[model samples]
Each structure stands twice: as C-alpha cells, then as structure tokens.
Target: MSAAVTPRHARHTPGLLRSIYLPRTADALAFAMSTYGIPLLVLATTRSAALTGLAFALEWIPRLAAFGWAGSIVDRRGASVVFHLASLGRALVLAASAVLLRLHPSGTVASVTVMALAAITGVLTEFSYIAVETAGAAAGRRAGRRAHRVQAVLLGIDQTATLAGPTLAAVLLLAGLPPMLAAITVLSLLAALLALRTPPSPIAPARTPKGQTGVGLLTGWRTIRSLPALGWLVTGLTLSNLATGLLQAAGPVIVVKHFGQSTTDVGLVWSAAAGATLLSVTLCRFAIDRLGQWPVGAACAVIASLATLAAAQAPDYLSYLVLVAVLMAAEGGMTVVLRTLRSLVIPPEKFGSTLSATILILLLPFPVAGVLTALTPPDALGHVITACALLQGLGLALAFTRLRTDPALRT
Candidate 1:
C-alpha cells in the first residue's frame, strides 16, 4: 500500500490537485455549517447562553479525546479510506439530527440529543480532517519542489471555505434550523463522494523489524519528541493557540459589552476578518518564496502578537475590527508556514499521528481560556489578552531561534 512516487520534474497535474482540494473544501463547508448552526439553533430553541456554550463545547471537546487514536488508525488503514468513511458517517449523523429536529422542535430530550449528536459529529470530523490533511501532505510530496506552492493553494482553498461557510450558515439560519441541517447533510454527502474520487495515498511501511509489527497511539508523540525542531515549533504553536483561544472566548463579550456592538455588527466584523485571512493565505506562497519559510513564519508570529495586543486597546468598533483583521491575516499566514514545515519534516507514515498530536496540544488550553473568560471581569479582559499575547511573543521568539538553526528548514 506504499504510495507510488512521481518524477521530480513532473508538473502537479490538475486531477491530483482536484483530488486533494475538492473533498477538503466540502468538509470545511460542512464543518463551518455545523459549527455556526448548532450554537445558533441551540440558543434559538433554548434561549440560554449557557446551553449554547455547552453545545459549542460538545462540538470540540471530543476532538481532544479522539485525536491520538484517530491518527493511529489513519496510519494503519490509510488516510483516504478513513477520510471517506468519516465523511459518510458525518452525513448519516447530520441526516439523523435533521430528522429528529423536524420531529421534535423543542424539548429537553431534543436539546440533549442535539448536543450528543454534535459531540459524535465532532469526533468524526476530527478523524476526517486529520486524514484529509495527511492525504494532502502526501500529494504535496509528489509535487517535489513545488510542494510549498501546493500547500499554499490548499491553505487558500481552506481559507476561502472558512470565509464562505460561516456566511452561508448565517444566511441559511434565517431560513430556519431544519434547512441548515439539511444543507449540512447534503454537503457532508458531497464531501464523501469527493473523497471517493481521491486517489489512494502512498502509505509508509511499518517501522517495526521484520516478523514483528505493532504501533501505539502515542507513536505520534514519540515522533515529535525525536525531532527537536518540530517539538519547539509545536510548543510555539500551542502558545499561539492559547492566545487565539483567549481571543475567541473573550472577543464576543468585548464586542457586545465593551464596544456596545449589536450581534449583526459582530458577525460583520468576523466576516471581515475571514476575508483578510483568505487574502493572506492566497499570498502565502509568494511570501514564502521571497522570504523563506522560517522568516515569514517568524514575522507572522510577531505581527499576530502585536495585532492581538493592539486590539485590546482599540477605542472604537472600527479600530477593533481593523486590528482583528490584521490579527487573522497574520495567523493565517503563520498557519500555512507551520503546515508546510510539518509536511516537509515528518515522515509520510507519521503525518496523521503527528498532526493529530499537534492539534490535541493546540486544543488543550481552549477550555482554560473559556474558564478565564467566565471568571474575569470585563474591565480586566484587556489585561488578560495582553498577557496572553506576550506569552505568544515569547514562544515565537524561541521558535524563531530553533527554526534558524534547524537544518531541515534551511532554504
């Protein structure tokens, strides 16, 4: 089941690119729909901020628990297979949820069932996401020296999906919850069909010696530990995610409470931020080519940290929106660089496991950020955000040094 290697000089064929991007874009759309729709539906039905928050948490917390094991499965069984299966499973879940919602529009049972379904979908989504990423990385490897360009294109596709998905969800929600769920179910099915079209990804042989074969869930963690530079990079990304988590947990409150913005205004601001992210990701390939990956990554980190800190002090809604846009742009560029580096460094066999482990680390602090947001006073939110930004800055500095010395990252 090992992947057949392509010649170095061969151009990245259109079919290959489509195989990688189409399914991923569909998955992103489905994800965005579920992420936005579930919370809005919960809030609209239950009229409780606490229940809405719970629904959101249910959609993410399971990812942490499933990451390691999912990665192991991707490695053993092949990413393409896992990707297709997960999408099919998500489609079924969404369809079932839609039917339930139609049957029982309002009740404690319906609400609990929705939350449970969201959690199950979350777990399946994580698996599909990891597998798709692994498959993309494998495709990039086949692109040879153009691998970074392929990565940038894929990242751009993802950013565009991010921009479109939420806006579509918002629009669809006005039509009502059942419509939204039905739309998501259709998207999930489309994603599954796209996955079926993807060519089989090259799989790496077992690392175990001949006549002995076994792999542990922690294999990904061990692989990261063995690579010092990757370890440092993941640590920096984890810190960056901590700052992002704080912003996510507190940004809405800051908008409504501090800026006195309406919910519509809040949505507009995020839409603007998403647009910025899309633009930045589209330009990432050129930036990496001109400046090198490490430098571009370091600059993005600095920019993100500064923008985040500055956002805490914005005097008006417009100023805050501008700062948030800048922050998201920088974060988007940084993510492309990090993902490119991950694809370049990790062995093909370990891609799924290592990436999942990385995501697990990234997600670890989000719950803590939510707790802090709940406990902190509105007046002190700025101080907390500034503190997180500073921590991110320090981690980025350390990561910059590590990258500069890393032989694998040298252009």
Candidate 2:
C-alpha cells in the first residue's frame, strides 16, 4: 500500500509567488521611502548638512539595539502579531511627524522628535523582517526555496521603492512637505494592514529545551562559531558589510568630487544605483534555478569589485554613473543569493532573533567606517573605493572558500 500523505504535505511544492508577501514587501518600500527622503528633506527644510547627518545618525543608533531585543521577542511571542504592532507603530510615528512638520515647518525641535519617532519605527522594521523571514522558512526545503525566491522579488520591489521614494520626495517638494509626509504615513499604514493578514508561522514539530527563548541570542553566536560553513559565511558577510559601508559612505563624495556634480545629482545617482539592482534580481532568479547561493553570491561580489574599480577610473561623471550602476546591479545578485541562503538555513521560531543577532554582528563596522571617511577628505573617495574593493574581495574569498573547493556546499 502507498504511504499516507498528510494534508499539509503536498506532493509538489506550492507556488512561492504570493504570500502576504506584498504587504511585507510594501513595508520594506516604506522605509526605503523614509531613508531616501531623510537626507533630502533635511537639506531642503533645514539646509544644514551637519544637522541632517545628525538626524541620520540618530535614526541608525536605535536600529542596532532594536535588532538584539526585537528578534528575541519575535521568537518568544509571535512573528505576525509582532509585525503588525511594530508596523502600526511605524505608521503612527510617521503620520504624527507629518502633521507636526506641516504645522510648524521651522520647528527643528519638533523635527528632531518626529525624526526620532521615525527612528523607533525603523527599529520596529527589523522585527517585522524577522516575522516575514519566519513565515518564509516555515514550509521546509521546497517551500523555503520558493519563499526566498519570493523574497528576491520582494527585495526587488523594495529596491525599486528606494528609487521611487527619493524621486517622490523630490517631486513632492513642489507640492510642499505636509502632503508628502501624510502620503508616507498612509503608505506605511497600508503596508502594516496588508501584513496583518499573514498567518502565524508554523513552528517546528521538534521541541526545543526550556529557556531556549534566551538561547536565541547566545545560540546564534554559538551556532556561527560551531558550524564551519555558517561561521565562514557570517564572517565573510560581516566583513563584506563593512566594505559595503565604506563604498556607500564614499559614493556621494565620489560623485561630487571625482566629477563636480550638482545637488540634484545625489538623488539621480541613488536612483541609478537602485535601478541597477533590478538586473541583480534577474541574475539571482536565473541562478537559483541553475545553481545555488554560494557560487552566484561570490560571482556577484567579484563583478561588483571590478565595477567599483571601473567607477574609480571613470574619466567623467556620466562614465562614473554608468559603471556604478553596473556595479550595483552585480551587488544585487549577491544580495539575492545571501538572502536565499540565510532564509533556507535559519530555524523558524528563532528566525527573527537569529537574523537580528547576525545582522547586528554584521553591521557593526558601518558606522565606524562612515565616521572614518567623514573625517577623511571627500575628494579622495575614489581611492577609498579601491581599498573597499580589496576588503570585500578578501571577505568574499574567505566566505566562498569551501564552495570553491567543493561543488556542493549545503547539499
């Protein structure tokens, strides 16, 4: 007699294209909007680079802290519920700020408050990510594969938003600030509501030991330390993020100094870079079908490195943008693969917390790098890109060492 099939266990995998994924993706787009807007908005209203930088710095400060605690909560309480609460809070924070910004345009004090609230919302986003990530992992291998593919698509949409938000902020500036802020709030709320429909993720049938809740935090470190593949991947990723941070810190200056550019150029370049990620999305989708994560990810970084070198060498502004766009598109491929790998391997209940811990550990170098470059002369940004490329290349090499040696990594 044939074996009995469980109702939840379909013979073939279900399609991964949909998920309460849109709302989750939309929430990503919301922050893309907020981040893209922050620098520009600050510049337009306040005209102080230092103040804008301060606000940006202020927002990022809480994100690191939030990553640690929120992920743990997601593991213990619930991913979906946590997502909704945090997302709703994100909306309210922005909406309130919009109202205040409109009423008192000159109020730096109020702006700071709202900006900080926005920062809090930003913190909540990390947890929302945990929730979505948990849902993606709930379905097991085939389901997990599809889920991550969906994630690539989601991130593509998110990348598109990065371009769209800045463009929107620039265009909306003509209409004035209040309406724009209100629009951002509405968009965030819409995202939150959409996320509300996502069902709670199915927990693993295997029972974890008591006190495993707190274990999420330490366990991630222990896991990374213990697992050879995961450890190298995490280490490489952490180093790669640091290099990426340098690249990001140096990019605006590269445009401004390497080739004298207008203020408008910053937005234009950002749009170009984000637009490039669309191609990365395409490459990743193709790769997931033809190959696995590590190979494709390593290749992506290699391409980005060469592209960065090209950007460093470009004779003029137009040439630089073209190279930079190509480079970012390549980086996009790496990003997709990384996301897929992380989702496939991480445990469901602790998905958020583990990811949070991993990211917090990974992103530790970005702020320091930013400060380092800020203190450095802006004109020499291109030279720094070369240094960043070397660092990232080394990391990528280390991360992919196993895969390069053995064709099948996880399999």
Candidate 3:
C-alpha cells in the first residue's frame, strides 16, 4: 500500500470496458435503466413500491459479497478469461428470465422472475467490473488512465439508455409488455457476444504461478494495514464511495416527491447526470494527468456537495439540469483518480483483491443509504447526503496534502 500521492503514477486502461467487459456490462446498464420501468411494472401488476425497491436493491446487493471473490480470482488469474466467462454466464441468466417474463406477463411468476434476474445480473456486473478496472487505470502509462476513460466511454453509451430506456418502457406500457422486453433480450445477447471478443488484458509482466496466491479475501486488508499510504488512499476512497451512495439514495426521493414527477422523469434526470459523467470522464484524460488525483478528487467532491445542495433548491428544469451536470462532473474525476491511485498503491499480486476490498467498502453503504432514506424525510436525507459528501471532500483534501503521499512519493 503505497500512497504516492498525485500526478506521478501512470493509470491508463483502454477499450477493455467496451471491448470484452462491456457486453455484460451493457446488459446490466440496460437493466439499471429499466429500474425506472420497474415501478410501472409493479404498478401495473401489483402497485408495490416496497417490492419495487426491494427488487432494485436486490439487484444491487449481491455485489458486496460477490465482488470480493471475483476480484480475488482476477488477481490470481488474468482479467480477460474471467471477464468473458462471467459475461457469457450472465447473458444466459438474462435470456432465461426474458423467456420467463415473456411466458407470464401479468402474474407473480413474471414479477418474481424479473426481480431474480435483476439481482443476479447486478451482482455479476459489478463483480467483474471491479476486476477489469483494477487491471486498467493509469496516470500517463495510458493503461493507468485508460481504465477510467474506458469506464467513461461505456457510461456514454449507456447514457443513451438512461435517456431512452425508461421512456421506451413507459411508451411500451401502452402497447403491451412482451415486445419491449424481447427487444432488451436481443440487446443483451448482442452485448454478450461482444464480451466474448474482448482481448486479453495487456497487463505488464504477465502472471506467474507465484503470483496466484489465491488468498485474495484477506490480501487487501493485510496490505492496507501494513502500508500507511495505501491505508489513507483506501480510507479516502471508501468515504467518497459511501457519500456517493448516500447522494444516489436521495436522488429518487427528491425526483418523485419534490418535483412531482413520475418514474420516467426520475430516469430522464439521471440520464442527464450520466451524460455529464460521460463528458467529465472524456475530459479527464488530458486534465487528470496534469492535475493529479488529490486536487481533482477534492474539487469534485466539494463541488458535488454544493451541487447536491443546490439540487435541493432547484425549482425548475434548467436549474435541475445544471445542478445535475455539475454533480455528475464532480463524480467522474474521482472515478479516474481513485482507480489510478489504487493501482499505484498496491502490488500487482494483490491488485484485484485490494481493489475489491475498497469497492466492497464503497458498495456496502449503498443499501444502508437506501434503507436510511426510506426511513427518513427527503429533506433530512438531502442534508445527510450533502454532509457525507462534504466529509469525503475533506478527506480528499487531506489526501491532497503531502503527508499522506510523502511516504510513497519519496521513492
């Protein structure tokens, strides 16, 4: 766990996201887009918001445990083989569910079927995603910086769905259900085939039998505890991820209640955020290398917190869009910098596991925030999310200082 600070280590990873890892990821994104559609489906079938959130969170929850093992496996092996296989497998899972949904459009069978599919796909996507990213990120080596850019690119492609998927589902509601889901099924299969073609991750030095310790579960914990720099990096990232989750939890609450919009409106606004995230990531390649991790992360966090608060105050569409743009932009740079620092901080053998550990910590907050927001008033939730974001910004600001980096940067 080295804390070499900012602007020094190369953290580029390219095309890996779209090339092979994407097929399944795209499907997952497609499904995530369909989350907006779920409430409508539930409304049509049973009208249960609780069930809808349960299914949605169910889709999201598995990653917390599954990613840990998946990350360890990637570290022991190379990224390509595991990534491809996982994509292929999840495609099968979706296909099966699509068939079940098609067969029973209005019954408990359909509802249960869709929920199960969403949950399984959600777990697999993040599980594999953590590994691919761990292998990529760079500052200048192109591979280092490329990882986040690759993420950014996929995000751009998926934003179209964020922009379109919910509306498509909403429109399809008038016509019927079978045709719309059938279309999604076809797209999922296409992406799966693409994942099959993703090239072997061009990681340096390759792997040796010695590197396959198969001890990934405990590796990140051990490594971070041993290294001060890595510890600070993980702590900072963990806080950032937790805060992001809190913010995410508050978005839907605000959209549906405050704005007096339907589920489709919520999806549309998130799509706007996704679009901004895409742009932010694209611009980060040139800007991130020169700016480095600390300043980039700190600035983004601070701005995002303010933007979130502003989102609370935003009364109309224009203000909402602007606020969402700044908030999304704030998130994207940290995605790049965080991955870059993680790669630079850890040894190759422990890369996947350590990254997974960090991700798991980040992810764990998601369900907690979801439940918390469900219980609390939206205004309180907004305040809580903003405060959490501010704390993370302060953490990043601390990392921006030389103390966290002095040990690792000194070489």
Candidate 4:
C-alpha cells in the first residue's frame, strides 16, 4: 500500500500563511521602527521640534502622491510583483541610508540626507503595505478561510509589530542610528525574499478598454462614489486620521518637553499603547458580533475621543501613558470594525483600488497636522488635541447616523 499522503491544500495552507504572515510582519516592524526612530533621531540630533514635525510629515507626502496611481498599477501588474519590488526597493533605500549615516556621522548635511532617504523609503513602504495586505486577503480566499478570520489574523500580526517595533527601535537608537538602519535593511531584504514565496493574487480584469490605460485609476473613486455609506465612512476616517496625525507628530514632543522623559520612556508608552491595541483587536470580533459594526465603531470613536481629551489633560507621565493606551485600544478596535465592513461592502474586484483610495483620504491630513504642530506653541498643544478630538467625535456621529440608514448595514 502506498504511504498516506497529506492533502495538497493542507500542505500549501501552512506555507501560504507563513509567506503572507512573515513578510507582512517584517514590513510592519520596519515601518514602525522608522515611524518612531526617525522622529526620535531628528529630535535628538537637531533639538528642533519643528524639524522633527517636518520630517514626520515628509514621510507621508510621497505616500499621498503615490496613492492616486498605486492601486491601478498593482491591479494591472498584480500585487505579488508590486510587493516584491517594493520590498527590494525599501531594502536598497535603507541600506543607502545606513551607508550615508556611516559616512556623514552628524551635521546639517547628514540630517537632510537622512530625511530625504526616509521620505523615499516611506513611499516605497506604503506601496509594499498595500500590495501585501491585498495579497494576504487573496491568499486567505485561496486557503478556503473566512475573510473575517483572515483579516483578524493579519490585524493581529500588525498589532504585535506595533507593540514590539517601537521599543526595539528606541533600544537600538540608544546604541546608534546606523545599527537600527542596518537591522531595518535586513528585515526589508527578508521581506523581499518572503514576497517571492507568496502565492500571486489574481489581477483584477482591466476595467478600461484597450488603449485607455490611465482610466483604471478612476475606478476606485467611482466605486466609492457608488457606495454612499462607504463614502461617508471614509470621510469620517479622514477626520479621525487628522487627529491621529496631530497626536503622532506631537506625542514625542509632549513626552520629551512636558513630561521631561527620555526617548526610552517614549518607546515604553507607545509599546504599552500597542499592547492595548492588540488586546482590543483580539476582542474586536466579539464586540462586532454583539453590537454590530456601526454601533461598535461609533462607541469606539466616542471612547477614543474621550480618552484623547483626558490625555490632553494628563498631568504626569503615568496618567498620559494610561490614557494613550486606552485611546489606542479604542482606535484599534474601530480600525478592525471598519476594515471588516469595507471587506463586506466592497466587491472583491474593487478591493485594491477602493482601499487605496480610502487610505489616501485617511493620510491626506498628516502634512496639515505636522504644519499645525510645528506652528502651535507647546503650551497650547493640549487645546489643539482637544479640539481635534471634538471634531472627530462630531464626524463619527454623523457617519454612524448615515450608516444606520444604510440598507447594507442593516444585515
């Protein structure tokens, strides 16, 4: 008798999951490192809060520009190739940054060079993120798993990286920037290799006729326009992101100047928040099932807003840390609910484009946030955060009201 053989799908599923999970986790880790490390390094080197804010904003500018075309390109070429190329591009850019740091050591030239490299890497990383996430969903379908479960696992990996990456970056920065950049380069290369192993996502059929190459770029916008509720949800998320951007740009400044804490402490606070986010993600499905996506998301937005207001008034480091954790947990849960809702509402063929458009809307406010942070006085940062939170609360209320009337949401 022939030896018993494992089913092909069973054997491939584990490998497929690894391929999707490893690269995504690595990419998320690299992103988090850069997100925290770059700002910390800028502040430490320049001692100019304005420059730090500018650098943070610069990272997202290119991402915003690329968002218009990235989805169409990925849809036309397929996500696997885009993902692999983006990974390689990021690795090369990081390696270049490490080399430049080794050469320049410290100066105005060094700062400018590092900032430029960060912006370029940010653009590449954004593209990689979109491709990998789209591919992961496709892989889940291929593996015969439910979409919600797959999304939960992917979100878990992301939260885990967010939990660990910042702390790792802060610790490594204590050693030096070059070492941190080197580690990121290695991780990027590893992501590239793993991308090679990932199963290819089937490309969306071209929506435009032959000879109408750029027309596909509009598909996502049209899709969003067709879905009234999704359009409103995206609009609400844009406001939420504005508040998030302000917090991101100003949080370190608050820790360093107001709390008089070290970079290590900043990392600790963020790590705690990330931990809370992970816990919230784990509980998200239960909440969504019990309360429904719209109600849970609206409740989360309210909680996040309240936490933001409280965080602004926090008198000490510990209080600020606790409020930050609570805020991040609420935001994390809301993110999961929004993602699941998007998956349910958007057609499979339109996912890449529609999601890219939504991400673009979500990120458009970061540069504005950076400008506001740089312009505002340190003493008034709390007032600004509180105002943004209130605006976000208002947007969420309107969005939820609209969602309640949506026929798709009723089911």
Best by TM-score: 1
Which portions of model 2 miss their true places by more than 4 Å?
1-18, 38-48, 101-105, 137-148, 200-210, 215-217, 378-380, 405-411
- TM-score of each prediction: 0.89, 0.84, 0.75, 0.79
In candidate 1, stretches whose alpha carbon ends up further than 4 angstroms from where it belongs are 1-14, 44-48, 201-217
Q: lDDT scores for all predictions? A: 0.78, 0.65, 0.60, 0.75
lDDT per residue as tens, model 1, 1-411: 223322111112336646777888888888877877778878877778998889888888787788877877776666767888998999898888788878887898678768887798889988888888887787776765566777887788777777788778878879988788888888889888887775542333333221111243476788788888788888987888887888878878989999898878777777888889878887777887777778888888889989988987889999999998998899888787777777777776566777788777777888889898999999999999899989988998888787886865665
Q: How well is each residue in 1-411 modelled by candidate 4, as lDDT tens digits?
A: 111221111122336556778889888898888877778777766678998888887887787777756776565555667778998998888887778777887897778877887688878888888777767656555533244456666888998887778779889988987878888888888888887885542333333222322334377788888988888888877787778788888988999999999988887887888888888887876766566666777788888888888888899999999998898888887777666656666655555677788777777788789899999999999999999988888887788788886764554
Please give the lDDT score at residue 267 for candidate 1: 74
- lDDT score for candidate 2 against the true structure: 0.65
Which wins on lDDT, candidate 2 or candidate 4? 4
TM-score of 1: 0.89
Query: For residue 319, what is the lDDT in candidate 1?
Result: 94
Across residues 96-191, which tens digit of lDDT does each residue of candidate 3 receive? 766776778667897787677667777766655654455343321344434444444544555555666777777876676555555555555565
Residues 1-411, model 2: lDDT tens digits: 111211111112333434445765666666766766665666667777877777676667777767767766666655556667777887787777776676777766666754675467668666666665555544334554464466577667768777777677667766877766666777778767765555433432223233454555575676556556666777776666665677677767776766679767865766788877887797688776677666677787788777766776788888877877877787677666656666656644445556777777878878867886888787676677677767777887777876555433443
| C-alpha RMSD of each candidate structure in angstroms | 3.7, 4.7, 5.8, 6.3
lDDT of model 1, residue 262: 87
The best-first sequence of candidates by TM-score reads 1, 2, 4, 3
Off by over 4 Å in 4: 1-16, 38-58, 96-116, 139-146, 173-178, 201-218, 252-267, 289-291, 312-317, 374-382, 405-411
- How far residue 232's Cα lies from its native spot in candidate 4, in Å, is 2.0
